[model samples]
Target chain A: MKKINYNRELCDFCGTCVSVCPQDAIELSENNLEITDKCTVCMNCVYICPLRALEVKNEG
Target chain B: MKDRYDVIVVGGGPSGSMAAMFAARAGVSVLMLEKDREIGLPVRCAEGVGDKGLRSVVDINPNWIAQKITTVKLISPAGMEVVIGTDEVGYILNRKMFDPGLAELAAQAGSEIITKAYVNGLLLDNNKVTGVRVRTLGREFQVKASIVIGADGVESRVGRWAGIKTWEKLNDMETCAQVTAQNINVQQDAIHLYFSNTRAPKGYLWVFPKGNGLANVGIGISGEASRHKSPFAYLFEFLQTNFPQAAIITTVAGGVPCAREPEKIVANGLMLVGDAARQVNPVSGGGIVTGMIAGKIAGQVAGQAIIDGKTDEKRLAEYARLWQKAEGKKHKVFYKLKEFVYNMSDKDLDDTAKIALQIPQDKRTILQLFKTALVQKPALILEAIKVLT
Candidate 1:
């Protein structure tokens, strides 16, 4: 499965990723960005992140 | 920690703040939770509002005014320009100050305001919202409320958590990119709008001047059309062509819901306002005024429901009824108009502009321009009359 990784240092918690995610997978809480199991790895957030804080990874 | 309140308003944008303010003014204990440490930072909006649309709701604070605009210029694909001048004015806002200022007003009206409070989910009892579960500063806690008002923006989780279908079609979503640029030569008092399939693709590009050689340059492309090219790329190309010497100050990318309001804005013990409710104007993709209007109505109804001791869907349905009567009906018409406009070819748009320009400049109005565009649809003439008048 392809997974997502978020760089906390680069994220400003803009919530743009949360809005673009069709599956409701990404969340921005106080601690950090959390990707849930519902993620289809469609990479919507990866492209939408203004700061380039999100990256996609394949973890088989 | 205290965990209960009469009303809990989620998100601290214009809608949430207005909801909180009105609810608190109604003599109810209201709590407003904002996820960001500061309200309105990382501004996402182009921040233009018509004078009538804004002043009808709240007093215009001078501090929030970035620029006062009196003219609007529409540029067609073939470089045809049609300028409309009117006594009716518009203002571009400094959202960084405008948002927090509205929140401050809510606080002054007696709503308890808390920043850095991110709502993780709802606390439900028997499928009815009882409160919200929040995470703040690495701590998790639950706060109970009689009514949960979801004024959260387009990315609203509160509505979905409450089981309302808040989905939008790809064609109805506008992928947007904006930048505040310095040293751009723009008409100081005129806002420019550019329309073309190649330039914007089912959307439009805008240049709103903020005075002193600064302007907000932005583009909004329909999400379906954006598949071939990102909104950022479209905007970058436009900027390079028009304002090559402009220095970019900040860049922002986001999505705007350009669809009809969801059928259901209220559920058991819950109500949605603002972008969560999809109250934005489909044609303009502008929501500040509409959201605040929805917020006002939602707050009033929620406050009344609290006092009446009935927080179910039946009582909460008044919010939807009132909003539909107020703006939802018009928004529905605008949605249809948006579809009609988006379907137009570049040549069609150029022809429409040429036809509109045939009319004398002094006699020209936005209504006349729309009439030219929709001249083929006689039925829409009546609908446009109702909407424009």
Candidate 2:
């Protein structure tokens, strides 16, 4: 399945993903960020991230 | 974590600390939670604040200020410069210390503070915010409180959970990128702002000096404008074109809400402050002072309401009413001004710059510039009268 994946090394935790999340799936505190189950793989976060920290990849 | 408290403040920024400080000072038990390992690590803001407005809320600490500025320069799209000598002073803060200083005041006021405490969810009782479900170091706790203050920054889950509609529309959201750079070739006495739709649509590029050969250079573009090309692209171009030799030390990107219409800041047993409430100035996209102001008012109201044993929506409306009168009403006028000024074409801006140049340097104020340049609209003149005076 094609699933959304997050790369912690690149994430800035600036909450740009939270700002654009249609499902409110992204929860971002100051130092940490989590993508909740409410995510529908809409790809808004992937496209808007300035660092390209989030991506879509095949997962088993 | 305790079983219950009078007020629980989420986040430990200016707004959160201000709220916690005033609430605790009013003879209530307050808890201020910060998710980060330290209170002021990983600075996110442009670190700009007005001296006069900042003093109204907290004491001035010279140790926290990087630079104190008195003059500003505005660059037109056509490269015309309008140098403005402001009556009020501005400060570029070192938020690594400034934020924690505010939290220190909150602690001194008797608010219990906990860092490395992440609030995952809200604890609700009958659809009203009763507490927070926070996680700390692989352990979870249901910390209860009579009122929860959401100073949780731009994308606030606390405000959203309280049914406060804290989302920002595209027009009001600013996607920003900033870098602390060294060896920038510019005067350090004045803040420089450049405006152009092609460069920064519906926003401006800024260079705030930090005194010792370092500067904070940044750009903000509307969320809608950034959809095609990210702010990173614009900043990269800006650095290449302006200060190609400057070395970058730190870079950050974030979303700042500059909403023309603020959300309902108060709900049953819960209050929102700072960026969470969209209390930011619409024109400048500055929120620190306004957030501090909102936090003070919310804390006082939350304290009084809790002391009276009533923490319902009806009782909490005082915060909304007071905030509207305090800063929200003026923000409405500012948003109108932003719409008027930024919507002007490059030709119009160039024309305004020409007009502004005719005035003596000592006589040029922001109000005078608006009065002369905004001669195109009669309705706007009426608004100008209400605002400038």
Top model number, DockQ: 2
What does the lDDT come to for candidate 1? 0.85
Per-prediction DockQ, in order? 0.33, 0.48
**Model 2, TM vs. native:** 0.93
Question: Pairs clashing in candidate 1?
Answer: none
Q: Give the Å error, residue B135, model 1.
A: 0.9
Off by over 4 Å in 2: A1-5, A30-32, A40-48, A54-60, B376-389
lDDT tens digits, residue span B1-389, model 2: 68789999999999999999999989999999988889888888888899989999988999999998888899888889999867889999999999999999999999999998888889998978999999887899999999999998877778777766666666677888899999986778678888888888878899999988799999987777776788889999989988998899999988788775545778888998998888888878899999999999999999999989999988999998999998988888888777676676676677778889989988898878888777744556666665665
Best by TM-score: 2
Backbone clash numbers for all candidates listed? 0, 0
Candidate 1 per-residue lDDT, tens place, B1-389, comes to 36899999999999999999988988899999998888887688988888998886788899999999999899999999999757789999999999999999999999998888889899999989999998776799999999999988877888888888775656777878899999978788888999998899888999988889888999988767766577888888998988899899998877788977777999988999998888998888899999999999998898999999999988999999999999988898888778777877797789889998898887788767887877745545666565555
lDDT of 1 at A56: 85
Report how far residue B271 has shifted in candidate 2, in Å.
Answer: 0.2
lDDT of 2 at B83: 94
- Chain B TM-scores of the candidates: 0.95, 0.95
